[model samples]
Target: MHGEPAVLSVTRYHPENPIKMFLLQPLYAPLLFPNTTSDARDHCANERTFLSWLRLAIYMAIVAVAILVNFHLKNQPTPLERRLSHPMGIIFWVLSLACLVTGLAIYMRTVTKYAKRRALVQTGMKTQAVFLVVSAAIIAACALFLAAEVQASRQGHAGAFDVTFVL
Candidate 1:
């Protein structure tokens, strides 16, 4: 305490106790900043929220890929059907990218908010609800488009193709 800063005063390591030093060095280590401003709980919740959004983004990407794959699985979709599928897949992928960016932005903003606030404040659920509704609407519209195309394709081929069982 006399001539040195408090953070480095406690950083001494005993040569015989490497394990303790290894474990405790972090407590006394001096970095650019003293330490993170937010508490452990706030940081953890923010991370969980961020990770959940990341998982959703990844799921959206998978669904986007699957949508295109499903179109290819069909024997022969009409030109219009192929073109529609392409846009649907691309839109889904774009949504996924948006989700990733939004999630990261929210996480960073929340962290900064937590650091500056003296008390906890709840975020608006309305925004979350709107996002969910819009995402679901896009997915539902895509599904309906694909479904209609399949129905039309089936109806077009129903009478032309015949299958018989010999067994």
Candidate 2:
């Protein structure tokens, strides 16, 4: 296909059903809002940081939910599942929940303080960007691990349990 690299022909393939057509529209919705105007909000440095932190908190919540769903979807029997699902899973959820809550609480506190320190300006571009990239990778790992467990259970494989040391 000798053509411009950036140009994609959307008309080449048509949706085979109404559901596919319905889903395709939303996939391109963001492209349709190129000039959409954003609503006014706190633009202070601290406020922005706080908002980004809250976004991180939401991501952590999503990660926790993914883990929870994986736990509940385990195909093992109740006794076996209860035995396998203990300190490790509990610790994971607890740590994630703590991080999410702490991030959100600090974000709220910073927003309140920002209202008073409206003139203060501290743009942390480098630190914020680095933390965002690292934390997003961590969340992606959690998502991948959970998805792996789900697929394993679907294929009738025992989860990564300690079966070798049952002496």
Pick the TM-score winner.
Answer: 1
Q: How far off is residue 8 in model 1, in Å? A: 15
Per-residue lDDT of candidate 2, residues 71-136 (tens digit): 443244334334434433454455555555455444444433333333233434544554565576
What do the candidate models score in CA lDDT, each in turn? Answer: 0.60, 0.44
RMSD of each: 11.6, 17.0
Over 69-152, each residue of candidate 1 has an lDDT whose tens digit, in order, gives 654443565566566666777878887887787677667556545433432545556447636854785778567765656666
Alpha-carbon runs more than 4 Å astray in model 1: 1-38, 71-80, 118-121, 124-130, 142-146, 153-167
Reference-based lDDT, residue 56, model 1: 79
Model 2 misplaced stretches (Cα beyond 4 Å): 1-43, 71-89, 104-167
